[model samples]
Structures are given as structure tokens and as C-alpha cells.
Target chain A: MSVDLDLIHRYRRSTLTRDELVKVELELQRSPAWRSALNDTVDAHRLGATWAAVEGSLDAPTPSRLERAATRLGAPQHLTRIMGATPNLRRAWMVSAVVLLLFGLAVSNGERETATIALFLSIAPLVPVFGVGLVYGPGADPAHEMATVTPMGGLRLVVLRTLMALLTSLVVVGIAAVLVEERSILIAAWLLPAVALSAATLAVSSFVPIRNAAAGVAAGWLTLVVIWARIADDGVAAFRLPGQLVAAVALAVSVAVIAARRDAFSRAVSTT
Target chain B: MRTEADDRALLARVSRGDRAAFDELYRAHAGWLTARLERRCGDPDLVDLAVQDTFVAVWKSAKKFRSQGDVGAWLWGIAIRRLIDQMRKRRPTPVEANVLFDQVASAEDELFVGGLHGELGESLRSLDPDLARVLVATAVDGLTTREAGQLLGIPQGTVKTRLLRARREARDELARLEGDSR
Candidate 1:
């Protein structure tokens, strides 16, 4: 099909009716030769061939977070440290919690053999959580390209990270159970707070911004658990109310951020 | 033929561990890739990272090309993919940090300025988010109208309407610029 370049030029120079604009746009859209030229440009770029050695290509404006991230002395290194330390720290926390639990259990049950067996059985699920979170942090969003052009990748990344973190928390709690073998009553002690914190941490990621949220949630949860551990008889029960509230908000925020920014997420994934 | 040629020509050279070829490939494609990615990212540094990453990926995976399709498309496919990954990894920063392309002294500077430009580029810059995207997908990036619709999560007709709007804007801008020059 012949493209009337003159008509296109005319259309540009004068006010065309909406229908006329549409027709010219359609013509531009249908111009195979034009497309072939674009394709050739894409091809030439791929081939490491150019019409000439072009200097600078500006493309887009720079975003600040990236600037901050790149300029930060130890961001990637810090992220790497988190990768290395998380599992180890989690393991340490699990071991310490378990030791505490077992010591309490022994004190309460007076070295009863059956208590040891019960304690071992209770804390088994905690191991996996320790491993998963260490391996994948709460913010570990992996790369996927084609799917990034859609919203699916963002949703998938967030959901996957959430699951990993939750699993990590649960695993840590199980190990805590083992440590508190004798004080199985303490397992009865702050089990609710532990569970609540895990969910709340995941939920908080949505509202407080990306990098800071997980640490904030974890810090806040630990502080609360400690405060409750010190102050009350039924700390587990006390946690249920606040935990549920945070969890509800967290879930809402996660959903809203994902929904409101679906396009943004898609754009992110596409442009990455 | 495209794939075979690509494999024998570019991929083979890259796979042979030629950094020069990779660099050459990067230089050839970086301008256009930067331009397209800038449209989506609205950030220059991120676009630079994306461009750098596309080359890194090409260095690592060029051997995988197998030369079955257009290498430009393949490279673009890589650049576009990497840009999206960067975007997903971060929150959408409001897109205002344009490169100082207006300060550019020559076409060489324009070529390197990256991101979109010209009448289509200006029109795209002026459009609302949805309308702007449809124009980029169809006119600049060369996606089909249906494909543009799918990418933007809009209906096909909406894509058409938006494209029309973008074109009209471009026409007016082009006329205004021309009149000013005269």
C-alpha cells in the first residue's frame, strides 16, 4: 500500500478533522516500510552496527531512589550482608530461643525425659522459616522481563517474599519451642505475639515504604514481644488484639499498593 | 535466516568472549534502547542502569541467541525486559528528571540524549499517562495497536483514541514549532 507522505505532511501543517487525524494515524500505523525501518534500527543496534557513532542518548529523567541507592556507599554490600547475616542471625535466634525454652522446660518439669521429647516435637516447623528468610529477604524481588510488562510479576514477587518471611518467622518460633522445652508453659507463653509479629511485619511493608518497612516491623515486633514478655501474665492473649489490627492494615496496604500501582509495577518490570 | 545470521555473526563473536563486540553492540543499540526505556522509566540513571544491564546480559547470554530472529529485536527484547525489571524493583518515582538534551549542540548530541524526542516524542511528553503510553507503544516503540492495548491494560478502542489524541497533539506541536522557526 502506498503511503502519501505529502498527505501526512499536510495533515501535520493544518488542522485536520478528528476523522482525518485518525486516518493519518492509521496510515502511519500501517506503513510497513516505516516499520521495516524501525525494525532495521532495532536490528542494527543488536548487531553492533550503527549509521554512525552517535554520542549520548538521554531517554528518561533520573529517579531519586536510584540516585540514592547508587550513591549509597554500601547499599548492595549491605543487601549482601543481609543475605549472609539473615540466615545466620535467624539460626542464632532460633538456637537461643530454643535453649531458653528448653532450660525453662527443664526447670519446670525437673529434667523429665518426656518433656524433652515433647519440646523436640513442637518446634520442628521453625527451622524452614529460618532458612527461607535467610536465603530470600522480605524484599527480595527477583527479575522477570516479559511478565514485568504486566502486573502479574509485581504481585507474584510481593506474595513470594511474604510467604518466605512468614515461613521464616514460623520456623523461628518452632525452634523457640524446642529451647523452652521445660517451660512448655512459656510456649503457651508468647506464641501469639510471635505469630502476630510475623504477619504484621509482612503487612507493614506496604505502608511505610519499601526498604525500611521490614526492619521497622521486625524491630517493633521484637520490642513489643519483649515488653509484653516482661509486663503481663497472658502476653500471648494481649498480643492477639494488636496483632490482628496490624495484620488487617498490613494486608489492606499490601493490596492497595499493588492495585494502585499495578501500572507502575508493570512499567517498572518492563523498563528494568 | 535472521537467527542463523545473528548466531554466526553477532552471537558467535560475543560467545567467543569478545568484550569489544559487546561494547560495539552496546554503543549501536544504547541510544535507541535508552530512548525507549526512558519513556517508561522517566528516569535517566535508571535508564542508564537498564542500558548497562542489557549489555551485561548480552555479554553473558549472547551465545544463547541462536540467531533465529532479528538481533535488533532480540537486543531490544533484552533492553526492554531489563528496564521493566528495574522499575519493578523500585517504586515509581515521579518522572521529571530529563537529561539536558536541550543543551545538546548537535545531532550527535541528540542521538546520545536517549529517551524520546522529535514531534512524536514531544507529543508523547505532553500526553496524559494513559494516552502517552499508548502512543509510545504504537508509534515510537512500534507495538501494534492491539499489543499496545494489552500492554497498557486498556481496551483496543481506547488505545486507538489515545493514539489519535497523541497524533493530534504532535501535529499541533510540529506546526507551532515550524511557525516559530519561520
Candidate 2:
């Protein structure tokens, strides 16, 4: 149980043989008395400095469970980190999406009224459109300027964050569609316009702030729905074949614009 | 009594994301780990960051603790490597060891550098601090020569030459000390 002074000297001075070195290493781990003995030798100020360092770091928070799950499920660390940091993936965003879906379902309930159904479907697509817009715009990221200098900051960040928001919104919408039973068909009709508008929002974002682009796309979409209904005398007319074709065309054109101007995705339109 | 088995059990809980166990493990080793790291690094701020980095890595990958040995050794293994990484990042200008020692010398290192190791310590006390550091890392800490190079922020070849010179000089110093005693 007695401490070996010469052995400790040789160990610290690196004068010990390899076998002797390994023995002391094991001895330190296995022997509490040795550790205590070593501790006893350290002056209080030096040990206090060590304790201060440890205590300071104890407050650095661990990763959240969702982030750990993302890593466990095989998302690369960089992608998971980006997704976790994205402002649009906040719990508030998901809660708002859920609220929108619930409100949509409640308003159109049992009435099967064409006007109410059109209102619900039209608003459904805007949920993801708003989310995609928030992925990489000025005012969307507090670190937007700092982020631009990072390798992952611009278009790559936008695309990854957009997929996250869009998929989460789809899940919320999908759940609502199943709950409405017969109205599920009307809910399904929201798919084409949802993608088209989300794409159009990002495409337009290449030239303007995301907030301005999202606001314009949402306003334009609602105005188009009102005009089409007035001309056709039916609010539900936009979910018809010609309307779906328009959504399809919009999707195709927005994608082409996005590809051609992809560099614009990395910086805020105003800054760029 | 806290035994090796207790460390393993704590590590088992740590692997399952138990925060309490993690905190317990950190408390058990952080002081000692910090003390040891300070010997190799002159900057306390960098040492603090290295300690934090070590535990953070352990938090993420406690499940990878497959060695049947003491958790203490394993923790030191991770910590020393992390210290090297932190040092590389900051690359603080090297100050003379004696100056660093005088400025920050805690009572314990006073014991280590002057009082504790006796005559063998006297021999190494004469060796160049840089060469002495390579010996401590590779020999006492069980790091490979390449790892000692990384830990000391020197080229591997430099570490090799320094290590050889250190061992030869330490031997000569011991012989001189013995001759003086006679």
C-alpha cells in the first residue's frame, strides 16, 4: 500500500523500461491509494485550477435526443447538425403546421361545401411553401452572414433544410387526410399545388428575400384561386384537370429556374 | 469502494445515455486528467478546452469502450489525443518550461519537478524540457513515438532524435549524480 518514490520518479522522467511503464499505468488505474497518494501530492492551487476547468465545462449541454437519433439512423454528422440548427425545424414550426392542418379539417368538416374544401386545399399547400422559404433567407437565420462563409452555408443548406420541412409538413398533412375519411380525396388533391408552390417560392427566392418571395407566392396563389373560381363559378374548380396541369407546369418551370440560378441559393437575394 | 467494476457499470449506463452516470464519471477523472494534461501543455485555457472536448467525445461514443482494462486508462487515452488536437488548433507560442513553471507552478508540480522524484528526477531535471516531454509522453504515458510527436507538436523524426538524446543524457546525468555522491 506504500507509495514507491523512486518508481514514481522514473515514471515521470520517462526513465522506466516499457514493462515497468505499463505496470505503473495499470497500477494507477487499479489502485485508489496510488491515485489518492498522487492527488495528495498536488498543491491545492494546481488542483483547484483543474477543478475549475472541469466545472466550467460541466455546463456545456449535451446533444438533444432528436439529434442523437438522427446520428443513429445514419444521417451524417454534418447533415444532422445543419438540420438541427435550421430555424424552420424548430418545434414552433411543426406546431404551427399541425394547427393549420387541424383548422383546415375543422372548417371543411361534414359540409362537403365546395367553397370550404377549396379553401382548405389551397391553404394546405402554403404550409410547406412557407417552410421552404424560411430555409435560407435574410431574417430567417441570425447567423446568415456567418453561415455564408461556411462550406455548408448556401444552396446545400437550403436544399437539406427544405427537404426536412417539406417532409415534416407532408406527414402532418398525410395524417389529417386520413382522419377526414371521405374528404381524404379532396385532401389528396393538395399534393400537386403544394409542390409547385414550394418550388416557386424557392425559385423566386433566388432574386428576392425569402420573406418577400413567400409572401408574394402565397398572395399570388390565393388571388389566382379567387379569379379562377369567379370565372368558373366554382371554388373547387382549381383541383380539376386543367388546374393540376397548371400546377405541373409551374413545378417544371420553377425547377428549371432553380437549377439555372442555383448559386443564388447560397446568399440572401438582397446581399447577392 | 469505487472499484474497476463500478467504472464499467457507470460506463454501461453512460452508453445508454444516462446523464447522471456521465456526470459521475467526469467528476471521478476530470481533476486528474486536467493535472496530467497540464504537464504537457503550458496553457491552462487550452487544457480546459481539451478536458471539455474529451468528455464530449466520451458522451457521444461511450459504447465504443470495449477494452477490459480500467476506465481511467481509457479516459486518459481519449484525453491525451484530444489535447493534441486542441493544441494544434490554437498553436500557442512556446514559452520556456522554467518560465511556465515559475508563473503557474502549483505545489504538486513543485513536488514533481524538484522534490518528488529524488535523484532520477535530478537527472531528467537537467535534460531539455522539450526532449524530456517526448520521453514522458512515449515512455510514461505509453504513447507511440508518432503520437508523442503529435502530443508535443513536433515532427515524428524530431521526436525520435530528441527521445534518443534525452535517454542518453538522462543516463549520463544519473552516472554523474552517482559519481558526485561517492
Instruction: Compare the candidates by lDDT and give the number of the best one.
Output: 2
Report the lDDT tens digits of candidate 1 across residue range A40-91. Answer: 3333443333222221221223334533453475545433322223323444
Per-residue lDDT of A94 in model 2 = 72
Tens digit of per-residue lDDT, candidate 1, span B1-182: 12225334756787788766655555445655554454355566666677777776776677788555656667666776666567556635543322112122233322322233345645644455556556656664467787555444457898888778777877887899899999
Encode model 2's per-residue lDDT on B52-153: one tens digit a residue: 788878878899998487788888888888888887787783634311122322333333322324433444455545665666677556788888776666
> What fraction of the genuine interface contacts, i.e. the true contacts, does candidate 1 reproduce?
0.01
True contacts kept of each: 0.01, 0.09
lDDT of 2 by residue, A1-272 (tens): 56676656555444554334334444565575555444444455654565555556556545567768999999897788767775543566678888887887787777756756676778888888777765455666667777766888777777677777777778877787676646436668888988898889888888888778888999999998888989999886788889999999999999999899888876654373
User: Which residue pairs in candidate 2 collide?
Assistant: A43-B108, A154-A266
Weakest lDDT window of 10 consecutive positions for candidate 2 chain A: A17-26
For model 1, what is the alpha-carbon lDDT of residue B66?
54
Strongest candidate by DockQ: 2
